[model samples]
Target: MPILKDFRYHAPVGVDEALALLHKSKKPLLLGGGTFVLNTLKKTAAYPTDVIGLRKIASLHGIRDAAKEVTIGSMTTLAEVASSPVVGEHFASLAGAAACVATTPLRHMATIGGNVASRFFWVDLPSVLMALGAKVAWAGDKAKKTLSVEDFLSLTGPEARGIVTEVLLPKSGLTGVYFRHTQTMEVDLPLVAMAFAARRQAGGVKDVRCIVNTTLSRPVRLTGVASYFETKKVTEWKADEAADVLRRDLEQGKLDDYRLHCLCADLESLIDKFKKA
Candidate 1:
């Protein structure tokens, strides 16, 4: 571990106390389980002196379901989320994704809010959350605000001006799947991932969303892929046609032919399985 200079640490018991500390502190960093932050500290010179731990705040934990939405408190652990019957029964994809994170020991120590707040391109939760159209509710410097997951991740880093309080996911007719591809069963992070959330429509596909997460940058929405499925029958589809279309239009320009071909192949296989399900 790196040597750190002496600094004040604060543990606030409520949202009001936490917000007040955030407003008053300079260059303060919020501490959840410290899985990421602490690891970074040991490897690099970066460490926050003013740490404001959110663990003391009873309000910022657990999963709760209302009639219309499911709310996950900011400090809720990944293990807790994975074990939640509400998540498993109602949000299978979310539960599966949480259960797959790191491992059981790490999941027990990590928080869902911390996972999303990392906003790392390689992380799986953000992409899955994007497909679910989750919204983040936080206490901003000026006032409380809620922003779409997309908007929240667009910040330079985690929002320094706000303390993320909860994540709200709308409940309704939505189906989702998360696929992680890696070279090894464990240890290796996902080389490429595909996440999808969509609603079946009477005529065809409705409200389809596709996201791609890479280790290079933040997770990106594959909107172009989703567009091809609109009004198209899920059963009768051409993977080649979809691949060719996406290959030509990606904003990143033409990917290496070999890599693109492999990605398309995986995509086709996954979609076929989803269609059958």
Candidate 2:
């Protein structure tokens, strides 16, 4: 492992101060829980000259539960998110994702900001958040902005420089399930992951959002499958039909036969579980 080079650390007390530091530094990296940042620095030759820690910022710490929405501070630890009653009650899929991340010690140190910002396909939170229709709030040197999770994941270059302040999730009538499949019992990284969210209507499913990750470069919604489900009765959902829709929608060249099999099985299992609920 490469040793992290000497770097100046700045623990800013406010968002403005943090942005100022980030803009002024030759190579500045925002520090969330330091789980991803520190680990990356130790493994790669690329290292930032300055680290702007967000720990001192008071606004980026707790969860806010409103009548129609829930806002999670970017600096909030995964462990806190997993254990929060508000999150468990409103977004159980998110809670389950948080609880299954790495292990207990890493969860205590990993923040949602870093996890989403890292944009690693294997990371659990991004898929669940995207499926839940979450939005990201960012703070930068010039101004603050809010973007949907899908848009945020596509950012690059200057567009990705801002510091994430919070994650906003609208409270909805939809129910969701998040499933993670690892290669083995000891492996933390998932081989395949799926998130399913939908509102059970009188005659069928509504507002269906089915996301698949780990087997792709980024999480992608199975729009074809979702549309198929939206038109069919919940009791009539079939595993083979769901599998055929997804196979037709996705690029077969990107996934081999085994992965395709796993994806189909997981999606079928998720749909069965969702219907039973």
Candidate 3:
């Protein structure tokens, strides 16, 4: 590992300038907090030459609220998101996910954009967002477009020409439960992460979603697990029954046999916790 060769640096003052830089460069990497980039540069063979720092851009680092939804600027720090009163109150699952990310110092320096944009499959936010049915607002060449988190995580799609501007989450009547299984209580990557959100209609489960995050290529949705509870009484929740159904519903080879077994049990535990909580 060695220092990266001297390359041009662009610290755009605002979003327009940032977009211009992106449009002009053939290959430009957006630099938010630079936590992962800097580390990789030092320890790995992956390092980009042209770095476009978004830290100075004020417009890309705030939160906004409207009558129907909440918009979170892409460059906002994870720490800021964790402490956002609006986020904590309305999107408790998201806030909790942000708070549990890395650590106090890392969270303070890790931007939401970089965290979400990383290629790592175990990153927590995307799964939670997908489960929440959140949408990401992207600005590009032809025109701005928005994609649901699930779509954004798709394996093949149109390459986003510009950048992710903000994340929009609809205001809904739902409660969220997030569970991460780690090797220890200290800072460590999650072995398995589960997020569940349910909307109660007349005191019964009306809508439910579950997302499982791992080190694989992409997050996995336990559609079988979710479908089992739909239109059923929440009071009759049974972990063992759901696990049996999930074993038969999900793809047979998505995970290794050992991991598949563990994750199934984790999902069951998550459902039990949600029921108790």
Positional deviation of residue 95's Cα in model 2 after best superposition, in angstroms: 0.4
lDDT of 1 by residue, 1-277 (tens): 3565666899989988888887787767788888887677555444555788999898899899989999999999989988999888767778888888887788898998888877777787888888888899878777788988888888664354668899898996678888776657867566666677888775457788877765566777777778887757877567887776667545584445544555687669756865776
Worst 10 residues of 1 by lDDT: 253-262
- Model 2, position 79: C-alpha lDDT score: 98
- After superposition, candidate 2 runs with Cα above 4 Å error: none
> Could you give me the TM-score of model 1 versus the true structure?
0.90
TM-score of structure candidate 2: 0.95
Q: Which candidate number has the best lDDT?
A: 2
The 0-to-1 C-alpha lDDT of every candidate, in the order given, reads: 0.78, 0.87, 0.77
Q: Is 1 or 2 the stronger prediction by TM-score?
A: 2
**Clash pairs for candidate 3:** none
1-277: candidate 2 lDDT, tens digit per residue? 4556799999999988999999999999899999988777876665788999999999999999999999999999999999999999999999999999899999999999988988887788888898899999987556799989888889888778889999999999678788888778988877778888888778687999988876457888889988989988878888898899988878643776766788898878876786776
- Models, CA RMSD each: 2.4, 1.5, 2.3
